[model samples]
Each structure stands twice: as C-alpha cells, then as structure tokens.
Target chain A: MSKLISCYRGAVDAWECDQMGHMNVQFYMAKGSEAFAHLQNALGLDPARIRKEKRGLRFKSLRTQYKSEVHAGSALHGIAGIRKLDGDVIHGFIQLFETAFDRLSAVYEFTALYTNLQTDEALPLPGDLRDRALALADDHPDIYQPAPFVGTVMPARPLKHMFESSRSSVDVWECDIFNHIEHRHIVGYFSDAATHIMGSVGLTRHTVRSRNLGSAALDYYSEFHAPIKMSTPVLLKSGLMGAKGKIFRFGHHLFDLDSGEIAISTTVLGCYFDMTARKSVPLPEEYANFPAEKVLAKQL
Target chain B: MSGYVESYRGQVLASECDLLGHMNIQFYISRLSQAIWNMCYFVGMAPEEIKGSKRALATVHQDSNYLSELMAGDIIHMETAVLKASTKTITFRHRLINSATGDPALTNISTVAYMDLTARKAIPLTEAMKIKVNELMVDAEDEA
Candidate 1:
C-alpha cells in the first residue's frame, strides 16, 4: 500500500452549510474538484506546464458518497490517491475527513482523461508523471470502503410515465467562465428536484420544520453527459426509486429542451433526520407507506 | 436508439465556461433538465396541469457519460427518446450533439416516477399519457 497524499486542507464556512445545518452537497463537490487539481499537481502535471503543452484533463465521470455530515467551522482535510492509471485516463479516489470529529465525511471517485486541448484527443501519461502518480497510489481499505451503490449499474427498463418537474433557462449568473453551468449548480438542480419530490410526498420544508425533522442526502451519484449552453432552457424530471425504514432513494434526469437530449443522470440516497438530535430518525407513520419498489410496480 | 427527437438547443456563452476554458459539468445537467420539461409539455403534461392536479414526477436514478469537450460560442443540439415506459415510471435516453461538428458530446439515461402530491405515493400514468409515451418510445438496439 502506497502512502496517501495530503492534497487539500480547509474549513467548512458558514455560507457552505445548507438548511440542514451542514455543508451542502455542492460545496463538497467543489472541494473535491479542487482536490482533483491538487492531485494532478502532485502528480507533476503542473498548471503552467499543462497550459504550455495545451494539455488538460476532462472529467468523464464522478461518484460521491457522504458518510457523515460536516458542519460550519469544522476543519476539513482531503487525502487523495491514484486508484489506477490507464494510458490517458486516471482513476482515483479522495477521502474527506472532518478533522474536528476525527471522522471521514465523504469519498469521491472519479475518472478523468488527459488530453491534448487543441485536438481534444486523449494522450498517454508521460513516464515521469506516471512514476509520480504511482508513488501516491494507496489503497486504504481499512480506513474507507465504497458504499454499495457506488458502482451499481442501474437497470435499463421502460418508462411507464414521465413528468417534467421543473424548467429554467440558463442565465449569466448561473454559468462559469467555461461557458457552461458550474459543477455546484449541477448538484443544485438535483437538490431542487429532490426538494420537489419531497414536497410531493408531504415532506416540504414547512412540514419538516413543523415536525422538527428534515431530509439529508447520504449518497449522491451523478454523471455529466454533456454541457448545456448559456441561455438554454433546461428541463428536469424526478421520481422515487425505493423507500425502506428511514432511507429513501430517488433519481433525476436533466435534459436539454431544444435538442431533446439527456444531459445528466443522478441517484440520491437520503434519510430522515431529527434536526434537534442531529441524527437519523425513523420514517413518520404518515410516510411509512411511501412508495417502495413493490408499490411502484403495483402502480405500473 | 432508433432516432432522437429534437429536444433543446442553445448557444454557449462566455460565462458558462470555467477557468479551464471548457464548459463546466453542471451546465450539461441544467440543459438536459430543461429539455425534460419541454418533453413533458409536448406530451400534454404542462407545468400548469401538473400543478393543478397536484401530480408530479420525481427522479429515481440518472446516469451520464461525457464524450467530448464543448467550449464557448458553440451551439448545442440535444435529442431524446423514451427507452421504457410503465404505468408509474418512464425511462429516457438523451444525446447531446455539437451543432458545428454534428457529433455527439454526451449521453444520459434517466428514470422517473409519477406521484400524487396529496397522497404522497406513486401513481399510475393516465391512458392518454401512456399513449404519448409509447409514441416517443424507441428501442436501444435501434440506436446502434
């Protein structure tokens, strides 16, 4: 087992926390993305050299699982290691720890392609860079194990019904300099869809607040299929996957309205929370029958 | 896979790019989500209808693959096809193409379920809605 590279260290800021009183999903992704760049630098792919060579990395896929909640003012330490190196693609994982609690908060797994920026073609990792990457390769199996859903391939099945849950046109404020929506906003869309779904299930903010309970995502897996242009109108669809005990799973699809294509797919596992206790709680009686796979099949 | 129906289109703007000089991952997700709303409207499930009836769709799972890089000033064209449709759920596949190159840049698969807001439970698709879904359905094998 190689040593884990200490890639990033930071703190959870007040602004990063959401209504659930913990750092939001987007912030986690942002930090993880930053750590990815740091890992590249550690592997000798310095930004200046990359730019000079007209070379860059494109993220092909990402999967994240939240194991514990991090609150504002919590100290954060991100450790990363190369999981695999295949020609132009780098497969890696990052573990985020809340130093204050001495507990792991999240894990991020990603696949990125090293490419020639001008031609947009993949390039093999140079020998020296590969050596550096290898030095940082570590499999800390004892400290972290991926969630069961991390790489689960969703079954391909026919749709019985589809509903358009939300619609919004991209605005300048919503985009970054790359001429596309930022990673945070992509997760934000999923968050929005989840909120809407919860609302449909009588788990709205008001209801949750009144009941002193809320919902929190335990795991989030998303894929970026394509980039959405600025000023484009986008659509969102959401639905339930399953529910058991206090855990509820859901999915979302974002499409480019004009082209009629899917741009992203996300799966989220969430749990009911007792806000005061800052811990998970059982599903409410009213929501106990919330559609599970059996109910969904029956409806179909 | 048979063939996709045009779903959405738009131009990449300077602001959408990141410091890396390419479109960010989030924008792709946003655009595709907008297209889904349009599809619902096309199938007669307008936002107003959903709101009035207190019925909504919720996402259960989504998977996507980014095939190519897209930059500022590029025009994006997206197409969508129904992969599967059931009484309470629908699965869809979307492909995004760069107008300039006419090559696919991304593909995504998503599954969703219909729900009754008041009852807070999954609901069956109406016969009318099911017919529209069937009309848009395409076999994945056909795309090959």
Candidate 2:
C-alpha cells in the first residue's frame, strides 16, 4: 500500500481571493497549515494530544511553489506524506490539486521538528513518533519534487539596506490553536510588504493599474527561526533580492522585537502579468530605478 | 474497486463548537453538505451542468453516526462511495475521519433523488449518471 495520505479536500471560497483574480498566497499557506496538522496527526501527534502536551511538529523550513492559479469556486484537494524521518527532523510534502481540472495548483515541501510550542524549542523525537513516521515514509518517486529553490535564497541575517516594511504586534485572532502566529498571517505580512517594496521602487497601485498589470507570487521559501506568540511586537525588514526580465525577487527578516531576534527569514519571487491577457510580462521599468547598492543580493 | 473517494477536507473552527466543547451537530451536517456537492461531481453530475440544467441531487433520506467528538482546529476529511442506485434515486455513504487521530468522527448515509429544480419533482437518472453510480459502487460489509 502507498504510504501517502489524503490530508486535505476543500473548495476555494469567493472571499479567499484578493485583487489578483485568483486565490491569494496567504490562503495557500492557510491550507498548508491545515495539511500540516493532519500530517502531524499521522505521526501520532493528534490535536488533543498536542493541546494537552503543548508540543507538536513545527516547520523549520517550508518552500511553497505555486504552479497554477485557482479562482473562486474552485475545488482543491491535497495529499501529504513523509519522504523520510532522519534524526530529529522529518522531511515531508503536501501537494494541493485543482480537482475540476485535475491539475497541481501548489505544493509545500517542508522540514519539521517536534518542538516546544511555547518556547519554539526543538525536542528530541519520541521513539514512538519516530517509529510511526518511519513506517509511513516512502520514496514517493511518482510525486512531483521541485528543484532546489531556483535562485538566491534568503539568509537569517539582518541586511544593511533592509528597510522596515511593517511593524505591529501580533493579534490573538492571527494565531492557531497553539497560540503561535499562524503561517498565513506571517505570509500576510509579506504580502502586504509588497506595497512598501514597490513604493521604494517608485511604483504604486495607480501606476500598476494604469498599465493593466497584476502581480502574483510564483514561489516562496520561509525559514522559521523562532515562534511569534500572540501579542508579540513584530517587525518586518525587506530588501530587493534582484529584479530582471519578467521576475523580481525580495527577501525579508521578520524580527521579534522583545527578543531582538530574527523570527523568520523569507525569500519571495514573483512577476507582473497583463491583467486582460492573463500572461506574465516583463518587470516594470520602475524596478530598475531602485538603487543598485541597496539590493540585498550583494550581501547574499 | 472504487471503494471511497474523498469528498471533503477542512478544519473545525472554534465558533463551530458548542458549549459542550466539541463540534456541534449542525456543523457535522454542514461539512456533509459540502461533501454531497463533491460526491455529485464524482458521479458525473458536474455542479455547473446541474446549475445550468436546473437539476440537482436532493437528499430524500439520511442516517448518520457521530462516533467521535471533533475539537476546534481538528483537521478532518471525508470519503464517500455509492451504496446502491435505482433509476430515480442513489444511496451513498460518507465516512468522515479526524486527520490527526485517524479516528472516525461521523458516517452519513444518504438517499437522494434526482430532481428538477423548476418543477420541484424527482426525475429519472440519465444513462451517464447510472454509469457513474455503478463505477463508484462499493461493498458495504467491507467498508466497516
């Protein structure tokens, strides 16, 4: 029998889409969050146990590749499985499909650790947990495995020219049952930071709209360094990674203000698309105007 | 054999829980309702086509078992398969499972009649619909 598990099945709600005419990147992270819960369950870390013990599998690193766009009213289903359980870290993946067209919409490849939910402390993998995960682990050669994140990846260091794109305290509602900020909210911060980054490049909603262009995230790689609990003061610093041809890349360092530590490091890649034509287009002329010395790729 | 195919996948929201601290009975049915639509599509009753033709599969009878309590944030999914089908009606069974525990939360069996929305009356199943029903049929004894 295949070790793979069908972990998610749901449709896109109309409200889940943003102005981009398709489901937003944050909503994809939301579904990935739900899928992660189930994957943890399969490893003997069910909800009741986690809520009682206050510990469960938490992602150390996650890479999301958006393959195709899904619109409102689209049905989505996902399958997840452990590729391997090595030492304290378990490698796994979740692939979400657009049911109507039977096409892969997005996939999340992740490395997780059983951790102290409150402290973000990695715990020793329990014997029973290791056994269960190993029993279900497989090569899963039939599934799609993306090439190691295509271009320059983000590092967890504060960059010299990185500017504050957003600063606020986490909200209670932005957390999951674990009381830690949900991955969707973290992605939300990055999504909103797009405006600030664009502003730095001398572009705005008016300028993009005048060109009938819409931006879409093509790939995202995030590394969680520490947990951001509810009400924690947070700050996001961002800098352009690179902008050339039709693609532009940006990097972020999300800081936990109280601890003065980088909570998460993320690299995002995306492109502008002609709204009416529904096709990717060249990076706006404005992107080239950003000071070359300010680009974070210099440090990377 | 087409034993069961997933019809629904989601999480329980905190608001959906009753004062008892588990998911409410109404929410179980609501998730089942979402499953029904997906099951219809599996049986070749594409929702868009049904919407255009003013035809739908309306449940005439149903029975369910709430075997386990579902807490908020619980990841859950449902799998369903056809039990039997006549010219005018099809009976199907859905098994809802808690993704974390791999325990059955609920099992719903529904008998639905093909209906004409405008006329508000049951209608006979089409040949293609019958073919899909047969393709999705599974043995009940083996399911349990």
Candidate 3:
C-alpha cells in the first residue's frame, strides 16, 4: 500500500536482541524514532537547521502498539504517513513490518508540537507544512484508519524497584515527530532524580551544576515487555546503586504504573568531576548521607 | 577434532545507527554476546548439544574496549578464543576484526559459568569438554 510518504527498510542486527533472542522492546521506540527522523528530513524539516534557527519541534505525546517480535538477523521495513496538522503540531501514524512476511510488528500514532527552539516554547505549525501533511494522510486511509491499542491491560503486578525515578512530562518543547524521548531528556531524567535524591540530602541543583557532567557513561538496556506510547503518563523510578571513589552507578526503571508492568530498566555509570579542568571531584557531604544499603538490596 | 570449532561474522546493516548516526553503545554489547554464541557453536556446544546435555552457559562478567568507529554495512568478524577453562567457568576473549582487511576492530573479554540447563544452577565443566575447549585456546602471543 502506497502513502503520500512510505516505507523504509531496516535490518535487524545481532545487537538488537536480548537474552531471550528477540529484539529488545525499547528498540521499537528507537527504530520508530529513527523513521521519524527520516520522515522529517523528507518533509523538509531539518532538525539541525531548526535547532540552529532556534525553532524546534518537540513530541508532546506518543502512542504505540507492539503486535509482534522482531528477531536478530531479520529485515524490517517501516511504513509511515501523516494524519493531520494544526498550525504547529503534527499527528502521524506508522507501522513496522517484517520484510520476510510483510507482517505488521508494531504501530505508532503520535502528536508533536512545534516550538520556538530558542525559547523552548510551543509554536504553531506553518500552514504550508500542515497542508502537505494532510495531503499525505489522504493517500493512506486504509492503513491510517485508527486501530489503536487503547486501554490495554498493564502487568497484573507492578514491577517496582526501589532505585527508580519516574519521569516528568516534557514541558511542551521536548515533543517531536521522532516520538522517542531525546537523549538529553533521558539524561535529564537521571539528572533530575540525582537532584531529587541529593535534595533530600540538602544539596541543590545549583550546587551540583557547578561540577557539571564531568564524565558520564550510561549503559542502558530496556526490554519492551510492552509498548508505551506518547502521553501515557509513564512512571520512572531511579536511585543511586553505588558510589566508589568518584564513580557512581545509578539504576532507573520505567513503569506503566497503571498496568503495573515494567517497560524498561536502565543503569547509568557516571564519575563526578570539576568538568572545567577535567578532573574527578570529591563526594559532597550531602552525598555522604546517601542510603546505600537500602539501595543495593533492590538491585535485580 | 582436538578442540572446539568456533566461527563468527559481524553484522552489516545500515539501521544500526542512532540519532547521531553512530552505532549506539548498548547495542554494541548485544553484538559481542552474539559473537560469543557463534564461537560456542563452533566448538561443539551448539544449542542442540546444550539442549541434549541439559547444560547452558550464562555470562557472569564482560569487559570490552572499543578502539575505533564501526559503521552500518561494515562487514566485520569477531574471532573468539577460550582464554581459560575451569571447573565452573570459562573465560573467553573475542576480537572484532574487519572482514576485508582482517584488522582488529574491538576487543572483548568475558567469563561465563556452566550451568545445569534444567535447574539453572552452575555446574562443573566436564574433563573431556575442557580439554576440547583448551585446544581452541588462542596462544597468548596471538591474542593481540
């Protein structure tokens, strides 16, 4: 089926799988996010230029359906089409299919807000882009007809962990057609959680920023036990796992608290430093008050 | 055969890039693990063999160093050799090499514990299997 805009091929590499030997869940978001980038570039929305122009597009919301599993060494193709466009926001629908069988593996329907890049404030969609997007939607009605997976059941039991922090909704400027949370946003979540825990110990965001992100290496892997779409109000839990010398390990998990399912679990490794001189920093007195024993007991 | 047989090949696909167009770091680990699987299969510890023997290999620790950039559609090979084999665990070293030039691309060292597949508990490596794997051990000088 042809849309005004259409499918792009993706290959499943060995690295996309988990111990279960299938594509990890977060990758659906990752791949879908990749497709959106291609779509935007095709639509004349150069994110770099937008960033340079200080006029950005952010994802206000996203919704996704993972109907099947993609395995290592498989080929997948994503088909996409725009649905509607208001002045600044664009709504779109996309499908990821296994090229081997042409079976639908995942579907995403999302809304994104255009924003003033410089101010990080929402902006109205240009009339020309809106018309182009609507014109594209009309080409793929059969596929665009909404078959969304609303109200799906959450895991019967919540997969809660002590050391996870829930994420806050993007403040309007972070939304985009890409749909997946931006890398900075993911890092910001941990930073916020660190601040929260630090705040409990009497350290403030201002005091911490003086050190900057000296050196941080985040190793994150999230299995898509299920799909989480945009605007789902997902819960994130984060806590410090351990700190030795200047290195600290943080663990985070994202949950669909409503369904009690663990959507993703992540671990981040970081080192504290002056960042200005590129040297390690000593643990602050506030960090001395960290709840270590309580945190280690919950590690999975 | 004196030792186990191992074979590996790197993935070549364009979709592996992240938003930055570089191979995302996390997926790199997954690729390394798969290479280890291929090495295991070459050594006669195929999935069918493991299933029949009711034994499994579970990773305990992994250490890796990335030397250079690897891109999508680049053909590479991960050559694996058993570094050490003991009663309960086996240590392995894997080198990711360019398929065309045969140059080292990345290095990974991992330890895996043998386990009773059914009970999911660690088990001792049999003498015969140990000897077989030792034959496949890459000489120390050849490791680099």
- Model 3, residue A94: distance off in Å is 1.6
Regions of candidate 2 where Cα sits further than 4 Å from its true position: B1-4, B13-20, B24-30, B45-68, B81-95, B99-127, B133-144
Greater lDDT among 1 and 3 belongs to 1
| Candidate 1, position A54, lDDT | 68
lDDT of 3 by residue, A166-220 (tens): 5555432333323433433444454456555555545676776664633333233
First chain of candidate 1, TM-score: 0.84
Q: How much does candidate 1 score in TM-score?
A: 0.60
Please give, for residues A23-139, the per-residue lDDT of candidate 2 as tens digits.
Answer: 988999988888777778778887888889888988989999999988765678889999998889999999999887789999999999989887778999999999999999998
The number of the candidate with the highest lDDT is: 2
Error of 1 at A289 (Å): 3.9
- lDDT string for model 1 (A1-300, tens) is 446766545556568888888888888876676566557666776544654676656566778888888765455667788877766667788888865356899898877777665564667877877787667666666657685573332222223333566788887776644345666677777766666787656676777788898778888776666667678789887666666788776666778888777777767778888898988998766556564442233333
Candidate 3 interface RMSD value: 10.7
User: Which ranking of candidates, highest DockQ first?
Assistant: 2, 1, 3
Fnat of candidates, each listed = 0.09, 0.37, 0.00
What is the DockQ for all candidates, taken in turn? 0.04, 0.34, 0.02
Q: Interface RMSD of the predictions, in order shown?
A: 18.1, 2.9, 10.7
The residue-level lDDT of candidate 2 at B57 comes to 76
**TM-score of every model versus the real structure:** 0.60, 0.84, 0.40
Provide the lDDT at A34 for model 2. 80
Model 2 Cα shift for residue B115 (angstroms): 10
